[model samples]
Target: MHRTWAIIGGGNGGQAMAGHLALLGERVRLFDVFSDTVNAISRQGGIKVTGAVNGFGPLEFATTDMGQAMEGADVVMIVLPSIYHEEMGRNCIEHLRDGQIVFLHPEASCGALAFKKLLVEAGNTADVTIGAANTLLYSTRIITPGTVDIFGVKHSLYMAALPASRGTRLEEAIGSVFPNFTLCPNVLYTSISNNNAMMHPAPTLLNVARIEAGQDYFYYTEGITPSIGAFVEQMDDERIALGEAYGFIMKTLRKSYFDMYNSGDMSESDSLSALCKKVVAYREIKAQKTLRTRYVLEDVPYSLVALQSLAKIAGVSTPCIDAVVQLAHGMLHGELDEGRTCEALGIAGMTKADLLRYVS
Candidate 1:
């Protein structure tokens, strides 16, 4: 079946999704707040995709107007950074219609919960079913204004709806376009399973001098040295402990990479750095040239800080996680705060069982 798709946020991930879906013969509209991006895409007549997927996906329309982009769409995919999740949610609340599915391409952590909170706070009862994926379906980057390079697509990924009851409906509605998603228990499972949080911040923080000095290096292979990789492993341990406190068994970052990319076998003796160096898709990916990048800004607040908040609620201590959060705050000059905390996500005082029941 052909579905009408409204792709919000015309950055790297959004362009890849809109272009790929259009290549599949689905009717697609692209939306972005930046007029420059909308105009550039419009001038090009379509998005050019290369590498793993190759095609020029001609969009039905490219506009800055939210209402126009979302009008009569069956699926709305928000593919922005988690920092913009709330802003996009606010922009979408007034435009959303009933029976429409709102999916965060990859909700850094607790994004669907935060978005659902915004909808209820505004009293917009549109019966919208909101869901989120653990990670993006493709490993891609934008080559230019209207062109993208997709390194690879994931073999499988996890997704879940806000209310546990709505998981089936969301899966059925999105199955035609996203058949690789495997439905999990609830939003907690999806949010707490975020591996980007485990991988991005520590390495970026450790490589601050290289980034500021404009050194070009492979982010995963060179940026993640043996010690940096071990530090990330410690943070990953805390993430797993957080999930345990909430009664879910989350996969380690190394194991998750193996599962998602089918990269290679994992020996119990392999170090995190060694495992990362073996991934073929990550070989050509370059490190950030500046300190003011998403690796720190987006992941620290949305993923790391948010995980710390969840850990506090679970009564689990995360010394390694806290250390990175503190360093990010100090180095970035207080810009990173307790973002998407329990209070912000509307689960402030809930116990572990209470959180389970709330999502259930």
Candidate 2:
């Protein structure tokens, strides 16, 4: 089955996905708001991918025009940060056609719901199915303009669609592009299963001084010390508890790491810190140089705050999660309150059962 892809965003993940698909002999078009990024790839005529998946993936074109990018795409892959989900949704509403599938590479939390809400609010009745993966398929970073380095590819990850009923349809449509995606119960499970919400913010917040001082270090190996990892474990527990409250049991951070990486040397008894240190993919990743990086700004607001909102609706307490949110808010000068919440996601007044039924 051949498919044409429209890849939105020109970041590391976007370039990697577009390049990988193009390398697989699929027709791919890359879209980015930044003209510089588009022109860079346009000049190169393709993305050069090295490391795990190495090849020069020639693109049909790279453009800033949304309509042109999506003109004939079967699958629209949004590979931006979660903060831009709403903005992208707005940009896509006027252009989306019936039967088009809009998938968020990593939705962070409630991304599909938020996107669907935007579409309904705009009164655009396109029969588009929104889906989300719990995380990106590749652990990759950009080496230069029009070039990316893939550190590792996840063995598997959970993916699901909004309205729950479209799960199978989404799988059938997206299977060729992401064969490793395992369909879960619904968007709630996929959102709740977001491991970044548990792993990123805690260690980043705990190591604020180093980041503020502009020191360099390995983010996972050195930043996540034993004490910091213990704090992250508490946050992960709250995430799992929130899932349980919503009738979904998610894997712990440690278990998720093992599942995604499939590292043979990982043990069931390894602590979170030990497990993180063992992951080869994370070894070369460096810590953020400043506090404004996505580790704190993006993850804190989009991921942690969203989780806190879900916990509120499910009547689940998340003290550890709350602590991080508060610390981030204070440190970042209260810039994170407008993140994805029940009201923002259009489920402000719904009960847990109502919310579950809505997705189901």
Candidate 3:
């Protein structure tokens, strides 16, 4: 059967996904509330993809109506910012029909868990399955209102359904679309294995002065120096420790990047600078034009803070992660600690065993 896919964001990832699915001949209905992206797609007749994914992906329909978008859809892929997951989940709950799957593309560190809680609190009774992708399948950007530039496609992506039981069916459905994705134990592995938490924040934070100075440099190639690489490795240690505490084996940034991009030989001693030089893809990725990029605002709050929140409960002291989170708030000039925490995710009071059962 040709399953219907309703992509619920019009951002870069959403556009790229719509293009990929439509290119593969899947029925697609894309929706966005704020941006004119869906509207632009309707006007343009299709969403165009350049660079790596080349083709026009037809949208069977595009809309801002939440209900209309979800009508008869098999899978609803929520590809929005982590902070908006709850609100989006709430909006989709009532309209989502039975047996529908809500897959968060790149859960940005346990976004699916928070979204699941929102679904429950919203009194959702439908037999809907919820799952998450550890990271997006592509490095993409909206080249224009109705076009996306896909730089690269991930070779391996992690996904898992909540409660662990719904994974196999969800895996088959998604795998039919994207065979690159593989199932993990659960969303905990998906969340903690998010490489963005390892790769994004520190490089941008360390390059804040350059971003402010309007330096014309490609972020990965020119920004991620040896010093930054060493710092990121330590940051990875904090994440790995936090995961180990919970009995999940998190992928190191080296292994994660290698699996995703497949161009770097990141050995134990290979610095970020060396890995950057080896990966040809990094050269095209430019630094953020401004200091207020998602690298800090999004990553710090949703990624690092979420990690530290779990780390605290797991009795792991994350000095490097904590320092970066503190530095990011200071640099961004706001209290970002109000991001998705254990308390916010309804896991603050649970013991380790209880937490395992809750997610399991």
Best by TM-score: 2
lDDT of 1 by residue, 21-77 (tens): 999999999999989889999998889999889989999989999999999998899
What are the per-residue Cα lDDT tens digits for candidate 3 across 244-284?
99998777777655654554355655665677766766767
lDDT of each: 0.86, 0.87, 0.83
Instruction: Give per-model TM-scores.
Output: 0.93, 0.95, 0.93
2 versus 3: better TM-score goes to: 2
For residue 185, give model 3's deviation from the true position in Å: 0.2
List the candidate numbers ranked by lDDT, top first.
2, 1, 3
Which regions of candidate 1 deviate over 4 angstroms?
212-214, 259-266
Candidate order, TM-score descending: 2, 1, 3
Q: How do the residues 1-360 of candidate 2 rate in per-residue lDDT, one tens digit apiece?
A: 778889999999999999999898899999999999999999999999999999999999999999999987888989999988888879978989988889988998888888888988999998888889988998899999799999878778889988788887787877756788999999889888988888788888889989878789899999999999999998889888999998887889888777755568888888888888988878988888877778778888788877877888888999999999888888888666478878888889888888889888
Stretches of candidate 3 off by over 4 Å are 258-268, 335-337
Model 1, C-alpha of 38: deviation from truth (Å): 1.9
Q: Clashes in model 2: which pairs?
A: none
